[model samples]
Target: MKKKLRIGILFGGRSGEHEVSLLSAASILKAIDKKKYDVVPIGITREGRWVTADDAHALLTGSQPPENPRLAGDPEATPTAAVIKRGEAIIVPPVPAESLQPLELHAAAELSPARPALALDVVFPVLHGTFGEDGTIQGLFELADIAYVGSGVLGSAAGMDKAAMKKLFAAEGLPQTPYLAVLRSVWRGNPKAATKKIETALRYPLFVKPANLGSSVGISKVHDRSELAAAMDLAASFDRKLVIEQGVGGPGAKPRELEVAVLGNDSPEASVVGEIVPGSEFYDYEAKYLSDASVPIIPAKLTAAESKQIRQMAIEAFKACDCSGLARVDFLMEPAKGKTKPRIYLNEINTLPGFTSISMYPKLWQATGLPYKQLIDRLIQLAVERHREKHQTRFTRV
Candidate 1:
């Protein structure tokens, strides 16, 4: 009999996409192969507390953990005691170690016991946005020397920031829309000047976004100067840097939104292209998670040549940012007019894309012949492979 690998499923992080992360984690927890791996549920609160135990799953799923009988009837009593009793907060040591240490909180000292450290073979972070996906947690994993899923620090940071991602795409000679990166301070310091600079570089019908956010949390489409100020304010509230991109299509036509999933390390492969028909004006946060009207077309309608070109571009964009393990590369295709072929522009890459059951990342791979379970397995395998490869390099002078 073979020993089962203990995989820690880290979810529910401190980000705007925290709820989305929980949804993704729930799907993974249900779908991951149990026979091959011993799954450990680790939940991080919005306040940044790391917790683990049987109740961790419950907490992530938004269910009430088993409460103490003594405090069940007390209206003023909080569930904090029951949560601490059922779940133990954890501390991941930066130095390479085999297990996670339990954090002893003074409030729950009596309720919680000092237990043996929890051992983990690998960490599958289902976290999204800010602290989790922007390389902060990846940096911690690097310091801890743990094999984790998704891109490394540099890849994650660059991927999260649209400005940096666009620069990388431009350097790789991959086609993308014209855009300007503006700082919140500069925009606020001289609104007229900042607006003038953006107006000069890019035309109206622009997309304004926070450079460091995901799931379209702080995104707005501005049609003219009337809406530009409001969009800038909204974007600036989410991130210090804003990426203002020129819209691809002309007149009333909307560009086709396409996506490709890239998987592996060293040599990566792109999945079949997929298209998103946004329910709203754009694939805003509401359309992505809140609404049920948005529809996804797998193996998007495209000519063989066009599909091949976009797929290759996706791989190129992924490698340009030094991404490993997995990523979902997005693209915008201008509507073809007359006899001319449509032009494809590479959009920003998502290092840690949503992994919910309906997410395009897994769906694209599934359409490309890899099912959800096998995709998860392959990602874990890639993470371990990358970790081993990294260890081969000499860190000290000979």
Candidate 2:
């Protein structure tokens, strides 16, 4: 009989997107196929504490883990740690430090029964930003040599930073709106000079964003000089690096928001295009999650040629960012106006996009004939395949 694969669904991170990640993870826990896999629910608190089993359940349900000794005495109920080394997720006693003082403790601890590892076959990190979505956690996965879902370290880092992603897109000759990257220190050192430099380079109606954030958090649209300072300040609070982009269109026309989902390891396939009609002036954090007014048009009304071009561009952008497993590529398009063929610009690529029902990434694939559950299955398969291929590489001279 085939053994049920042990799958770990990691959620609730230290980022501002923690709540959103919890929602995404909850959906997976309810919908994932239990017959084929043993699901492990791992939750990280906003304070960065990792919890599992009953503790994880408490975190998910808004209940605090029992601190009273009477309520927390079960040894098995204790929070278990997940470690990836020797190519599998395990829960072993942490190796002691190499220093002499710690070495004595290590020697003494070796006499005790080693804690059995959790043995996760694959980990699906539903975490959204900062330590989770950025390359930090991905690097830990690489060191553990375990198979996990989504892009590797390089891709995750690049995808998290808008400035870095745009540079890669530009190298590939993809069309994009003009923008400037600002460092918090530089802006603070000389606000007047920074304002002058921005005024000289771009026009009004610019977007200020924290380069390494997702879910439209710490983002603002500024119309004139007075608003730029506050917008920049807001963005700087989230990240040291800031990205200022020139608005896509002029006047009453808002640039059409289009998204395409790409799936696979190398030779990925692109899903049908989907359009987002934001409820607010722009798709702010409130409009993306808090409100239900936003509308999504599947297989967005586009000409056959435009659809083909967008699908192709989506794959190109995914590769340019070195993404694997899955990604959602966003594009800004100007509708065809007298003599002007619709101009499409590669906006950005989201390596670990939202998985909620209303999220565009999964929705785009569902529209392309791949159901939600099937999409999850395919992604797990891709992670296994990629890990197997990576193992083939000879790390040491053999």
Candidate 3:
């Protein structure tokens, strides 16, 4: 019998999406076949504690870990300074006229490497938003020399930043709506100038979002000039850079939410399309997580031509961003106005989309022939294949 792959399922990040991450990890944990893989669950709390247990869900659901004191990088902004917040890294020497101690640091203890932990053949990160989705965890995976599912550092970073993703999409000739990026410095230093640029370039009813957070945590729809500043402020609080987009939906004019699942590395493939009808005012966090009213139409009832076009477009978007393993590419289409061409606008891609059975990514795959368990199996295979390919490259010269 082939040795069962030891897969580490990581979840519960320091992000606001911590709860969502727990939900995803639960679904993935349930779907992975025990006969084929040994799943080790790793949970990080919002307060930044890393732990693994038979009761992994408890840590996440409890928020004791909070994954609090999490360490993440934001290239757009530099870290102020490394301050020992907690744990053993926070050590202080004896202050016998040589040192003064603080409450956070103890004089007796010394920093030591965390006790050796079991190595993982592959890891599946169910974490979302911020530190989890924005390449920080992926970079850690690279440093550990382990194979993991989803995009690598570059792809994860690009996918997390809607502003950067849109620019790359435009450069690749992919049809996209006009959008502007608000740098942290610009928004903080010159609010008036930033507001003018947004107002002049785009009209009222704009979508303000944090460039690197996901799950619509810091997203607001601005209806007029009066609401613009506040909307931008809410978004900027979550990230150093913010993305402003022209709103597509209006009263009774529902923007069709279409999503396609892409899988594999290098030569990747796209699955059938799925459509989501927002249950609330829009597809906000509540509509997505809290309410169960949203509808997901599989293989989205569209003309053959429309389906094929979207599948191709999904692949194009994936390749444009150099995504690997998997991504859920979302779209918004203006309803066909009296038989005119349906205008499809690529929204954003989730590098590590939700994995719960109800989530669109796996559901699309399930409709396309790979069942839940098999889909998880295939992702593990893809991880191994990607890792093997990595070994072929020459890192150091002889």
Candidate no. 2 TM-score: 0.89
At residue 85, give the lDDT of candidate 2: 23
Across 47-79, the per-residue lDDT of candidate 2 in tens digits comes to 665566667777788876444211111223222
Model 3 spans > 4 angstroms off? 54-57, 61-117, 249-252
How much is 285 displaced in model 2, in angstroms?
0.8
Against the true structure, candidate 2 has what lDDT?
0.81
Clashing pairs in model 1, backbone N/Cα/C closer than 3 A: none
Q: What tens digits encode model 3's per-residue C-alpha lDDT throughout 1-398?
A: 78777788888877889888988898888778888876677776555545564335567466353232323222211211111111112212212232222224222233223422244688888889987888977876775567888899989999998988998888888887678998878998999999999889986678899998888898887778898888888988899899998866443566788999999899989999899988975688888889999888998988899888889989999988988999999988886678687788889888998888988889999999988888888888898898889889899998
TM-score: model 1 vs. ground truth: 0.89
Evaluation by TM-score, superior candidate among 1 and 3: 1
Candidate 2: list runs displaced more than 4 Å: 66-117
Q: What is the C-alpha local distance difference test score of each model?
A: 0.83, 0.81, 0.77
Off by more than 4 A, model 1: 64-115
TM-score of each: 0.89, 0.89, 0.85
